[model samples]
Target: MTSASAFWIAAVRARETGRGAPLFIDPFAHDLAGDYGYATMAASERVAGGENAFIPVRVRWFDDLTMTSAAAGVRQIVLLGAGLDTRAYRLDLPADADWYEVDRREIFQHKEPVLAEHSPRCQRHIVIADLGGDWAEPLLHAGLDPAARTLWLAEGLFFYLTEPMIVDLLHTAAALCGPASIVAADIIGTAGLDAAAMRGYRDWCDRNGVPPPFGADDPAALLHAGGWRAEHITTPGAADANYGRLPIQPGGRQPGRTHLVTASLATS
Candidate 1:
């Protein structure tokens, strides 16, 4: 089977796709999710009340961010944990743009047939490898220009990675990307884990084989320590200004405390 989190995230996209005015529309999400995907949504609804709108909110944010950056002349896009993500097929792209998704071979096995049915909006490449290893060479082999401006998204990925691993990824991007390359990803703050939605998310992760092993209170400081410049950091939580959605679970409600971070490598 595919990763459990993969099923859950895809279900979120599928639900949004079926909505009247979704924050973003992902046409391939339902097909990519398959039967298990819909079942996952039903199961979550029975366990919890439908799916939390948080994942899709972040997805729309990054999707818009990508287009905004691309309009500014960014031609390369990389998705580090590109599981069940339909962006390559859904988004409009400049003719000069290229997209890369680095993930295990198993993940792409779930993607190929779907791509056979649907066309990608941009030039897309799949680099099959463990993200924690020497995947950079394969990325280069697949035609990523380390010196070019790039947009990198690692959404719904960092909380599962160790701090050292996250630092290594930042360092790798710094060494490989040009000075203007921008990266957007989600990170958890220490206070976020205790939030009701995140607490449920953590339980789902542990049951699904991926557990929450890391959370940072100050991603700005973490980025500074990792030698990157934090351009913007915001948490879209209960009654967040932009998203305008409150996370309600049982009786308690707290902020999502998720750091929707955007940053770039600092100049020497």
Candidate 2:
């Protein structure tokens, strides 16, 4: 079965594509999302009592960061739990750059058909493996060089994992990264786990078979423990991350706020 969570996110991207001045566009998103995705998204919005701009903003932020990494000469880009992401097909990447997407076999089976009609801007490698287990070996076997400067993205993925899993994932990526390799991820703060505003969404996740979202109080500290130096961290409404779409103002604490982070490997 196609993952409900992955389709739900694709549904959000599809909505973005229809916006007059969208943050980013994914032409293949609507088909990828399908009727199931739209239904799930509508149900989620009804449960949460409104729409959310978080996913759209998060998508835009990651896109910008990926382009920046490519421009900086990072040749290997990996997306953990890649879901229905279409960066390889949509983004303008360097000719020599190779983008690797890691996710379960089922998701790829569902995704590959939708993308088969499109050509990617860069070399795309699909490594099918369970993220909950030892996926590093498969990635290396797929031609991910541990010596190359790489960009690792864990977007919209960490909340589904436990703290230990998150740590293991970070360490695994760090082990495969060379000096100055970059890692960008979006994480919910620990406060989001039980925040009143997140109750409905949490329930929605539970009903959909997705675990309740959990995260660190200090994501920087967590990254530090895995030998990654947190270079930038910002909440959704912060000046750097906001794209004039957030309902709340740019300052003050927002309930269930997600943090966008960029970190670099501490050493080769």
Candidate 3:
């Protein structure tokens, strides 16, 4: 399966290149996304009815969370399914910390050349592994210390995974992360996956040869079952998540809700 990283990079480019002050700027996004990525994003937007602020808002939220975690002295940051993410270059991460970007081989092949001239602020390691398989092995082999406090980010990743896969991934992450580690992710509710309001999105994925997206109706409960203590759970249009770009009230819940979550590994 082709990694959809490029298309996401295109979305970042669109947001960063906009007129208004953007939430974050990804300077490398332009070269990483290229023409094909932009075309794919445009096609998806058309298929989904219109461009939405979900992607950009989530991007900003994750950026903020990463910065906060880094500042809190959590030195090991792992971006699972890292995609064409340019956080290491864009964010002012801790210089003493190690940033791990884990994804399949092809993603790096496409990313390396464009970022060859650019230098990351922190120690960045590229880990080659498919999330569906034994990714923990490669990640550990890449020098991820199990005893270090880690910030695990699975942004825009859980939706593509099956429920069982999600559980397994969380379990693996919990096993590897040291005490007091943080895990942040985004997940669509079952309503968003199956409700008529999201039918267009489902259809668009099908047309693009991507697997049907998965969702959890109760994201907090799902995280709890997977040995995590959900600290915060909020939808995309909520005040903290939305930067005045979403078309809703500060705390309004839109149709097809996508929940952004922050959790800590359970001690038990």
Candidate 4:
């Protein structure tokens, strides 16, 4: 039951960090993952593969947007389902920035010991809750000002959630975000699930008990329906082009591949 998907991404970040010149250097990444994450990661590399262009590209895109939000005057950040994420410790965020990381209590338990050894770049608040349950109440009570702009990061969260859960989370975000808030999330879709190459990865998720039944044929439209305007939607190919990360595959990229979507509150 401790197969934390966040651990997988943290492992990827560590791999990327060990490189000559990384896209983002998460110094706290390696220890946060600890031994088990690295073990699963080695197995993943043996089976599926290493960190793909999609992951690092998505990471950088959101990092830039987060700084942009801060520059634009948003001082609060809420990382929902924030498993082993170390942005509060790594990013060169504004000194006034406040971060709230919400996750299951166990994730924080695993992360806090590692976090105690480092100095966070911003003020950090940890909220433990069942994200599928009443997670927001704890966050709001923890001093997340609804009237102030906050950058909400969902990252690798939505794929594991069912449709009703996703919609409910979106509505909650919209209600809490106020105007000028930005939300960034990465979502798997029908196209990715249906890909011949992605089957192995799907099997990996299934084996790990995280069956991804929630995906979209049209990710941008899905966000629009969920009450946000997807101002930027980048597919794997486009992200590769942006970061010069992935080589163009043979034939034009197929439809419904993974998408990194960035949106804003549409409460006008």
The TM-score values for the models, in the order shown, are: 0.87, 0.92, 0.91, 0.89
- Candidate 3: tens digits of C-alpha lDDT, residues 1-268: 2366455555566556664788778877877888777776776666666665688888899999999998888899999998898899888987888999999889999889889998999999999998899999999999999999999999988888888888888999999989999899998777767655456656767898767888876777778777888888788778888888786544423345678889998977
Give one digit per residue, the lDDT tens place, for model 4 in 1-268.
3235678778889988988877889888888777787876777566555445567777787788888788888899999888888888888888789899999988988899988877888888899888889988999888888888878898878877877788788889888877877788877767566655456666766897875556775666667777887777766556332566676542222356666777888754
Full-model lDDT for every candidate: 0.77, 0.85, 0.82, 0.77
Model 2 lDDT tens row, 1-268: 2278789899999999999999998999999999999998897788666777788999999999999989888899999999999999999998789999999998999999999988999999999999899899999999999998999999988888877788888999999978889988888877667756567667777788866676766778778877788898788878778888875445323444578889998753
Top lDDT: which candidate number?
2
User: Can you write out model 1's per-residue Cα lDDT over 1-268, one digit (the tens) per residue?
Assistant: 2365687788789888788777888878878888887786777666565566677778888888988998999999999988888888888888668999988888889878887966788889999978689989999999999999888888888877878888888778777788688878777667756755455667766897864657887787777666688888776653332454544322112234567778888875
Clashes of 4: 0
* Winner on TM-score (3 vs 4): 3
Model 1: residue 86 alpha-carbon error in angstroms: 1.2
- Candidate 3 stretches greater than 4 Å from native: 195-211, 248-256
| Candidate 1 pairs with clashing backbones | none
Model 3's TM-score against the true structure: 0.91
Task: Please give the lDDT score for candidate 4.
Answer: 0.77
Q: How accurate is candidate 3 locally (lDDT)?
A: 0.82
